[model samples]
Target: MKQVRIHGPDDVRLDEIPEPEPGPDDAILAVAACGICGSDVGYAKLGGVQGPAPEPVPLGHELAGTVVAVGDRVRGIEIGSRVALNPGAAGFGLGSGGPEGGFTPRLLVRGAGLGKSLFPIPDDMPFEIAALAEPLGVGMNAVDQVDVQPGEKVAVLGAGPIGLSAIATLHDRGVEDIVAIDLSETRLEIARKLGAKDTINPKNDDLWNDLGRLHGTEQLYWMDLVDTDVFIEATGSGALLKKAIERGGNGSRISVVALHRQEVPVDFMTVLMKQMRLQGAIEYPERFENMLELLARRDLGPMITHRFRLDEFSTAFEVAKSPDAGAKIMIEIG
Candidate 1:
């Protein structure tokens, strides 16, 4: 079996290892496709999220595969069944006290704990689309937290994969008056294609001024008269969070979906004064099934922008890290 391993920062190597055998209550999956997530870039460039690298770990989580073999006790999911592998490992990547987390040619997954998260990929769903269920699940989870309403004004900060996923999720939920704000024109264009009603290049225009110009009098009630009802900050930059807070209206919900690599200052006094709801969102806890269902139903396909082969994993990572790279970057495994 061959797997991409991150030995250290900027030190990824493809290594061959023993093929995994499923234990009791486990299933071995043949990797079909895996999406390179933003977190994988952080891990590959900055060791790990909060600490140093734990092991020379295989780093992909957004994946879809087929069941090649199953353990004696595994049920419901049988061999030869096509499935989308949920690398979130039933919420926290713990995998019911299994071995370390990874993305190898063969994945040994616990059948019982997998639950609805490990969905049966529809025959109509392509491998590349199936690979995106995980990140779409993340965006779904964030939108679920904010509870976006139809016709409500929304602003999505940062047009990265997650941010664009947020835009897609919001659009799917029927929010038509959605605005995507980002510094990169490429990402903004991608966001617009994914149903963002308006795209703002933050570098060129003052966000509040633009909002006021677009929304007229309604924008004045919010910061500098920007009438945004729900604001999602996905940049993971503390500066963006603070700016979103300052620009949001009273009682508006601002969801923080990005993982900040370092701590930065925020305006606690302004939050209290404005009575804003600042919420922190993590990975999908219960939205994976719904996201998978949406994918299976073909409601979300515009977000997948690029695909590569397993041997081209480094190029995939580079594309993911590149500013010009659009939505999800997927690697074909099988």
Candidate 2:
């Protein structure tokens, strides 16, 4: 078997290794495809899973594959069945108990029970789309946190994969007034294609001034003057959070779905004055099915912009890291 190992920052190697033998309650998967997540880049830059490189670690979690070998205890799922993997059971990286992820040709699926972690997708779903179920699930989870009403305006901060997924989810729910805010014109264009009624490039346009055009109001107010009832901050930009607090409509909900490592200073008074509800969103271990359900109905092929074979991981990583790179970047393992 061949696996991608991160020995240190910017050091990734494809190494030959022994394939895993599944236990009675486990299974061995022949990986089909895996998506490169931002956290994987973090691991490469930090030299390891949690901190500096202490030992080699496997990277990649958003994956889908076929069950080549199944333990005797594994039921409901059968050999050669296509399945989408939930890496959340393991902390999503090598440092945690998560099975060495789908970056390898073969991976082990083991736990007290495999039901929650292994979701069977429709046989017709392409492996790449199946692999996307994980991140799309994340978007579904974040959107689920907010009670977005129909006809209400919504603004998403960031045009990354997750942010676009959020827009797709919101669009699916019948929300037509969506504004996607991002610094990338390319991403904003993608957002427009996905469902955003308007795309704002913070680099060129004043967000506050633009809101007036979006809502047809000079004074953006929560008292029906401002129509943005929900704001989803999908970027890790701390400044966006402050802007949401300062400008978000009264009683609007803000779903903070970005991965932020630093403490952001927010104006508590603004939050109080607006009576806004702010919440954080993490993994979508439970929303995989819902995500697949949504994917089943919509055309999500556009979300995937870059694809690379397992051996081309270095180039894949470079593309995934580039801001100009469009959306989902997948590594074909099989």
Candidate 3:
């Protein structure tokens, strides 16, 4: 079997290794597709997320695959079941747990359990779309963190995969007035389809004015505040924190989901005076399989804008980093 391994900064390799043999309580998944996350790119830059990797580290987490073999102890989950692999079961997920990752042809799941380590997807759903349960799960978690109200307006700062997931989930929840704000018009267009009632590109139009006009405005002492109740900041821009604080209305919730590298100074006095909720969100506390139901219902196939084979992963990373790649880039192996 061949796997994608990160040797060091800007160094990745296709390493050949022996395939896994499932134990009595294990299963083997023939990986079909995997999605490259921003964290994966960051890992490549740092050599490893935890620390420098003396041994090359495996590199994939968001993935879907088919069951090629199942242990006798593994009941209910049978061979040939089309499943979405969970690389997050504490010490069991690919790349995160052991030597194996989904960037390979096949992976072994120890103590394979249904709804725990493996989630069965619809037989008809494409593996690429099923893989999205991972990222979308994080988005759902972020949405849950803020406790979104039904009537409150929302402005998502970044229209990336996770932000789009939040938008889609908001749409599913009947949030009628969503404002998707980003520099990428391409993503803004998709945001509209995903349930963003309004879209804004700061490069072309004034973001503050568009937000104020679309969401309505209230005077906060001397500053004009956007009346949006929820501001999901996924853009990782330090300046956005200031914008959210300055324009966010009283009692508005700002769910910070993006990973910021630098520690930006914040106006605690403003937060205190406004009584706004500044919340940090990460991971999917609620089940991501629920997202599978939404995907099955809406066929969010269009959200996936780019696809590449496992061998062309570098090219895939290039496209994912490119502004024109739109959203949700997948590496198809099966």
Candidate 4:
């Protein structure tokens, strides 16, 4: 079998390796499409804890595949069945938790653990769309944490794939007043198309002042600009998180869904004054089914912006890193 490995920084090589044999409780999936996640680019650029580059690391995670082989203990799922692979087998972090965990041509996923996190890709679900279920699930989980209520005001910081997913999920949940803030105009445009009621280019306008201008009289009563009820920080920057805390209204819930690089300073005074609730969210614990169900029903075909071949993995990573790339980028493995 041919596989791509990150031998070091800026170094990705295609190598031949023996196909994996499924354990008694595992099944083998022939990769159909794999989405290049932001985390994959992070790994390629910063490497892992082991060294400067995650040597011998496979570089994908958002994926969908067909079950080609099954183990003795595997059941329910059968050969030829198309499935979305939940890249985080154990979890997302160090060791075997990150994208390096799912970038292979064939994935050996534990059968019992599969549906608990994975979902059967509907026959009509295209491989490219199916590959997005994982990150969409992440966005779903973040929104689930906020428990967005209908007609409530919502603010999503960041316009990356997950951020945009949050907007779509919030819209689906009936949140009528949605404000999306990002540094990139292109991403904000994508957010608007995805259902964000308002888009803010934080670089050009004073986000807080604009909020006051938009909601004038309401700003006094709302105070923290969170009169909108919920605030979601998906930028993965601690500074933005601190700002979200400062800008959130009293009793407002702020869900921290992005992973930051280091310890970010926060104003305890601001957190105390507003009595804000800050919660951190990781990959979906059990939201993949609901995400798939939503995708299966909605007209979200435009969310996928680009596609590339497995051999073009390096270019795929570069595109993922590019600021102009929009929505999800999928790697056509097969």
Candidate 5:
């Protein structure tokens, strides 16, 4: 078997390892596809987990696979079942530090509790797309934070994978007019394909003026632009956060879904004066099923713009870091 591990800053290795055997209460999966996350890039770039990268450490989480073997006590899932690994559950990838993750060709899940960390998917779904259940779950969790009413204006900052997913989720919720903001025109184009009503590139256009046009108002100031009922901050940019706060309507809800790389200062008065319902979203181990349902219907296949084999991880990582890269980058293992 081959597995990818991070040794130091900008260092990732694909090493040969022995196949894992399942315990009495465990199961083994033949990993099919694993999506590289932004967090994975951060961990790989810094060669650290908390502060800096440690010795050789496992580095993967978003994945889907087929159950190849199961222990005696693993009752719910059987051999040959297609499944998605929920890394948020214990004994999976999130907390376990061993040099094993979805990056490998196979995964040995510990405990009969394996059922708690896995979700079965339809046979028709592509493993590469199924791997998206994890990140899409993140978008679903973010959309779940706010009550986006039908016909109400909604805005999503950042046209990254998560942000685009949030826009699609909002569209599914019947919000027709969605504003997708980003600096990258390529990303904004993808957002438009995902059902975003308007795409704004602040680098070239005035965001406030654009919002005023979207709002159909002749004249508007920064504080006066308040038509958006739900604001989703997916960029983790303090400037976008301030813009979301400044442009949100009274009693609007804001969901901060991005993982901030640094501490961003916020104006308390802006939040206080408008009574904004601001909240943060974490991983969705329990909601993979919900995201799976959405994936079954939505044409989110365009989200994956790049695919690479296990041996091409170096090129894959480079593509993922590129400014012009599309929504999601996937690694397929067979």
Candidate 6:
């Protein structure tokens, strides 16, 4: 067997190793497809999540595979069933310092019968699309953060994978007036495909002006604010936090979905005056079934824009790092 692991600082390798033997409660999956997330890119640079791993660490988390074999104690799940791994669930190595990850052909999942880490997928769903369960779950959390409802207006400040995922989730939840904001026209186009009613390219357009014009405006004391019901901050821009506060209507909910490197200052006075609710969102806690429901509703195959074979992983990583790269970069394994 071959696995992708970070050996040391900037030291990722494709090491040949023995196939894993499953425990009594474990199962072995013949890996299918894995999505290269932004975190995977960062971990590659640092050789681990925060620092170099004591041992070689597997580098992928967004993945789907089929069960090749299962231990006698493994109950509900069976061999040949397609399933998606919960990244938050430990054991099936996912960018964590450990034994393995899903970047290869075979993966050993511990406690497969415990019903904690794996969720079966529809037989008809492609492995590449099913691999999206993880990222889409992230998108679900962002939408859940703001409690977006039907008929409410939304403005997402980034059209990358997470932003686009949020937009798609909003659409799935029946939200109509959705606005996608990004500097890339291409990304905006993708956002539209994912159900963004309108888009704003901040490079040539004023984000505040366009938002106000589309969402309508409300007067608060001497200041005017965009009446958008929900604001999902998918771009990690400190300035956007201030802008959202400045223009966000009274009682509007703002969800910070993007990760920021530095501290972002906020005007608590304005937040206090408007009674706005600001929340931070990260991984999906317990919504694997919700992800499967969304995947059942639509063909997420379109979300995948680029695909590469396992052997061409270096090239795939390069493409994922490119600004011009399309929506989801997938590494298809046999």
Best by TM-score: 3
Off by over 4 Å in 3: none
Q: List, residue by residue over 1-334, the lDDT tens digit for candidate 6.
A: 7778877766778888789889889888888999988877778788787878777788788889999988888899878888998865745445555566888898888777787778989888888888988988888899997778999999998887888889889998899899999987878888888899999998999988998999999999988889998999987889888889888999999999887767988899999999999999988847688888888897666678899988888888888877466778999997
- Order the candidates by lDDT, highest first — what do you get? 6, 3, 5, 2, 1, 4
Task: Give one digit per residue, the lDDT tens place, for model 3 in 213-311.
Answer: 998989877777889899999988999888898889988999999988789789988888889999999877656578788878875666788888888
Consecutive 10-residue window with the lowest summed lDDT within model 3: 89-98
Better of 5 and 6 by lDDT: 6
How many backbone clashes can be found in candidate 5? 3
The residue-by-residue lDDT of candidate 4 on 1-334, one tens digit each, is 7776666766666677788887777777888887777776766565543447434676666778888888776668788988886655544431233433456677666543344434588898887778778888888788888778887778888888899888888888787788998888878888888788898887899887775555332343435354647778888887778777777677778888887878988888777767778888888747467777778877566667888887777777778888566767777887
Q: Give every collision pair in model 4.
A: none
Best-to-worst ranking by TM-score: 3, 6, 5, 2, 1, 4
Candidate 2, residues 1-334: lDDT per residue as tens digits?
7888787777878878888998888778888999998778777777776666556787888888898987888777788888888776634343232447568988887751456677888879998998888788777778888877679888898888888889998899999999999887878888988899998887889886787579654233433335478888888888878777777776778999987767899888767877789988887736468887887898777788899999898899999888677778999888
Cα RMSDs of all predictions?
Answer: 2.7, 2.5, 1.7, 2.8, 2.3, 1.8
Give the C-alpha miss distance for residue 80 in model 6, angstroms.
1.2
In model 4, where do residues sit more than 4 Å from their true spots? 49-55, 89-100, 111-118, 215-226
List candidate 5 stretches off by more than 4 Å. Answer: 95-99, 112-114, 216-222
TM-score per candidate: 0.91, 0.92, 0.95, 0.90, 0.93, 0.94
Compared with the true structure, all predictions reach lDDT values of: 0.74, 0.80, 0.84, 0.73, 0.80, 0.85
List pairs with backbone clashes in candidate 1. 219-225, 219-226, 219-227, 220-225
Q: In terms of lDDT, which candidate is stronger, 1 or 3?
A: 3
